[model samples]
Target: MIIDLTTRKVKRVVKLPKTPFGITFDGESLICCCSGKDIQMISCTDFSCTNIPKTLMSQYSYIAIQGDKIVCTVPDDSKVSCLDNGKLVWEFKNESVLKKPGGITIDDKGNVFVVGMDSKNSLMISPDGKQYKQIQTKEYGLTEPSTIYFDKIRKQLLITNINSFAHLYDVSFY
Candidate 1:
């Protein structure tokens, strides 16, 4: 459903094939992590829907746009992947600390922020996808965090916990 924020009215309503969980815009279309085990692209101009074939996994939990690729978190496999042109371009190594990755976001520098659901923390990947750093320790009060958002303007990170209020961390120290 599209709403006109200026006039506060409903503009159009288009039904989707499945419930969208993680979504991102690639300038021209909206990419969604649909329940049908595929990435759905909704046209920004006409609201047309297209399902991209799933080639890497059975389900994708969260997604973020990283340059020309889409990085997605695979909860069931405890992995994260980058897809380009409906094909798996890269896959993060399945590490024990990455058990059940949920939320994901990428910064302008291509750094990846991913939620470690089982670890109750978040992992940061370098622009080259080589280095991994764990941030927001238990002492900082993170529990069952699911969603992550990066504020480029303020240089802060906002994370949502399933059972508690959202947490904000200043990333200016980085």
Candidate 2:
């Protein structure tokens, strides 16, 4: 459903193919990760849908886009994958660090932030998918964090748990 922010009213509803799990705009089209390994690109103007070839067996639960790079988290498989122009670039999987990875967001520099529902933590992964550092943990009152967003303009990170708690943090990358 599309809403007009100024009037705060429903504008138009565009029907999707399958149940949309994760969605992001790539400056041109709305890239949607649907259930059952279906990734589609819906036109912003006409709302025409085009299917993006799937490369993984696992379903995507969360997604973020930066330029031609698309990142998604597969909670069922406990993995995160990056695709460039619909081609698999890198896949990160470290159950010890991120178990059941759920929500995902990408920074201007392409750094990926993800939350683990099972691990009850959040971490930042390098653009190359090599290194990762824990940014939030259970000690920070994160209980089953499932969603995350990075505000590029404000340089803040927002994380929300499955329950009722939400956290905002000032993030700086040096």
Candidate 3:
């Protein structure tokens, strides 16, 4: 998405990070990784934004929010966790399982969806931090997934493969 600074309209947008960035939409706010450990949220009301800290500034790579909680992904550490207000609510670590964890998203029911670069299976987690399902998209050619989003308006899950094309999945549950 291009950010219009009123005086000019920027194009070919980027997140000012050496590595790729992660993003998520929580209906009311647009959340993005700050290249640091925390994520930044742009308020839908006035376009104002503030950072959500997660211990330090380089502990995370991406973030997603469920309700008022902010859930972020840490690749090198192979984990994901959430911060409530300003305190850590929960943390999960599995180096053998979540290698290079990348994109993340949250459903209306607070189910978390995440994709990893070297993961044999994408993951789903309950709001309480219980991993529920593992969805394999290898058959669909998703070898190195980068981004995932639950599009409310289209009732579908949009996924982007690194340096590749994007695919849409029907997730209407209808």
Per-structure clash totals for the candidates: 0, 0, 1
lDDT by residue for model 2 (101-131), tens: 9889998888999999999999899999988
Any runs in candidate 2 off by more than 4 Å, and if so which?
A: 55-60
TM-score of 1: 0.88
RMSD of each candidate relative to the true structure? 2.1, 1.6, 4.1
* Consecutive 10-residue window with the lowest summed lDDT within model 2: 51-60
Candidate 2, residue 139: lDDT: 94
Clashing pairs in 3: 37-57
Error of 2 at 52 (Å): 1.1
TM-scores for every predicted model: 0.88, 0.93, 0.75
Which has the greatest lDDT? Answer: 2
Sorted by TM-score (best first), the order is 2, 1, 3
Superior candidate under lDDT, 2 versus 3: 2
TM-score of model number 3? 0.75
Candidate 1: tens digits of C-alpha lDDT, residues 76-164: 88888887777877678656667889899987778889988887889888766667888875567778888999887788899998898
Which residue pairs come into collision in candidate 1? none
Candidate lDDT (C-alpha), each:
0.80, 0.86, 0.69
